[model samples]
Target: MDFSQLKKEIIEYSKTIGIDKIGFTTASTFDELRNRLIRQQELQYQSGFEEKDIEKRVNPALLMDSPRSIIAIALAYPSKMNERVTSKKGERRGIFSRASWGEDYHLILRDRLKKLEAYIIERVPEAKCKSMVDTGELVDRAVAERAGIGWSGKNCSIITPEFGSYVYLGEMITTIPFEPDQPIEDQCGTCNKCLEACPTGALVQGGQINAQKCIAFLTQTKGFIEEQYREKIGNRVYGCDSCQTACPENKGKNFHFHEEMEPDPEIVKPLLKPMLQISNREFKEKFGPLAGSWRGKKPIQRNAIIALAHFKDETAVDELIEVMNKDSRAVIRGTAAWALGKIGGETAKAVLENARETESDEEVLVEIERGLAFFK
Candidate 1:
């Protein structure tokens, strides 16, 4: 079978299907990435969301039988929103990171991969392929790097030259022996922008990140955010974009290639106060389409409370008092207590004082005490 001709056909077909970039690499074990994963594990810097087994993450052979090559594809997302949310006094908004601006990238990338997989199978009847997006055991960034989709940036994003770091990546491991593309040279040279711009210094150094301290990671946590990082979180309700926004390479690199990736400004940057009171059905109806809502309403609600405090939004005081008094979740009630203190009006202070007497949960009680401390 003419595998070289088949590979060429796949490349041409990819363009017709809206895949922004496609590259191929031999399915050798990723030794460098394996070592880095070990180091991240040793330092306890990894986000618990990753696959725990490091071996499966680095070896394509384990994921699919006799894998001969990996086909990496990228889909560019818009960095700038077409419509703007009107921000006025008493109606402040919180921002979701650009990655979460539209439909969940995982679904979009999976659709692309399925199309590619079907196209390959049609050409070679016996072809076997395994596809994955971010959640899979295989590291998407490592595969994209080796497949020449992009160079690994200092911010730990796969930085594609055409689309900057604002690209969604996925891969398919296949039994076809496609010639590998050369990896791009790292272009971040001496640029400390991403490292310097990280809100929590999550970028330990170039090409390394402490996910525990990353605002993007922290915003997704179901528990109480650490006290030290709460102020730094600012108005980000989902992920943080400081690192990507700071990179020079990404400057003016907005792409509105796919219709599904367009942002609904009101949804992505909704009013913080409304988020606090959104019912489960309402939350699913509104934010359910975006990737940022995957952790459900608790974390986003917690962050929204924190954002109100960051803005010191006096208008949200009444709602916050209600949450502190009546919310079922201790984390939400506790975070509301903290925000009330941070906002600190006579009413906010009075609510905290009242909750101090009635709040039963030990953790919520501690947060109430901390809230009262702000008044002193």
Candidate 2:
């Protein structure tokens, strides 16, 4: 197969498969992107895994059983009008990080990439392809860069002049040696918007962001997060998009997602009270396969309580009371107690006392007391 013809065929096939951009490169796009990953790992900013995890992904042999070439794809997740509602004046909003504001990209990207692979095999009966979207062991951002879809920004996200860093990336590892594209030159010269805007200072240095300090990781993280990081989480109920929001390059770009990715109005901009009231069963019914459900309702519910506390919305006091008094989960009870203190009044204090009397979790009792302390 001629590389030139294969390049044209790959691009055409990707578009047919619903991917917005497609590029090809060798499996070893790791070397160019290693510095950023190492810097984040060294700072203990990485989440989910350590330096060893990244090393495993970068290893082409591991990325694919026997990787030879990469066919990278990008899905442009352009921001919508509802996604930009960040002001304090808005009514209690269901806070979906930009990524969650649409259909789960994993399903969308996966189905499309799989179809593309099937198409390739139909053309070349012996061709084998493995596809991934934000998963797998390969360094996707680096692969995307090599494919000419975008360049890596200081925030460690791939940036395309056409779409900024909002693009969701996926890739196919295949033995096909399709013509590879030249990598783009970095365009984030002297721009520190992503660095300056990080709440936890995760973007500590030039083009370096600590994933551990990243709010998105915290919100999506399973199990209890370090208490110290909890206070810095802000109002993001799911993921955090602050750095991407601050990037000048992202301004004025419009994306029309396919219908599969539209945000559920109820979940798109959720009311704080309803989010708190939702049962685990209801949460699964509404968001189970969606992006935020991966961590279960606990983190998101806890995050809603924190957002209520941040807003100091007295109206949420009754709901917070219910959670403190009735929720079986200790984390929910504790966060509710904490939120009540922030919304303090006679009613808030009463709920805290009730929780203190009956709560079994020692940690929750301690939080109930701490909440009472704020009132005194």
Output the number of the lDDT-best candidate. Answer: 1
At residue 318, candidate 2 shows an lDDT of 76
Q: Estimate, for each residue in 1-376, the C-alpha lDDT of model 2 and write its tens digit.
A: 6767867876877776678888888766476456766766677766754336667666666655656788889888748754444334435654778677666888888998888888888877777788887866776777898888898888878999888888889988987767678889989999998888888887777666677778888787655555566667766788888889898999987687566666666676677778888877998888776766777888888888888887888878878887888887887888788778877899888867877777888988877887898888
Per-model C-alpha RMSD? 0.7, 2.6
Candidate 1: 10-residue stretch with minimal lDDT:
84-93
Model 1: how far residue 249 lies from native, Å: 0.3
TM-score of each: 0.99, 0.91
Error of 2 at 165 (Å): 1.1
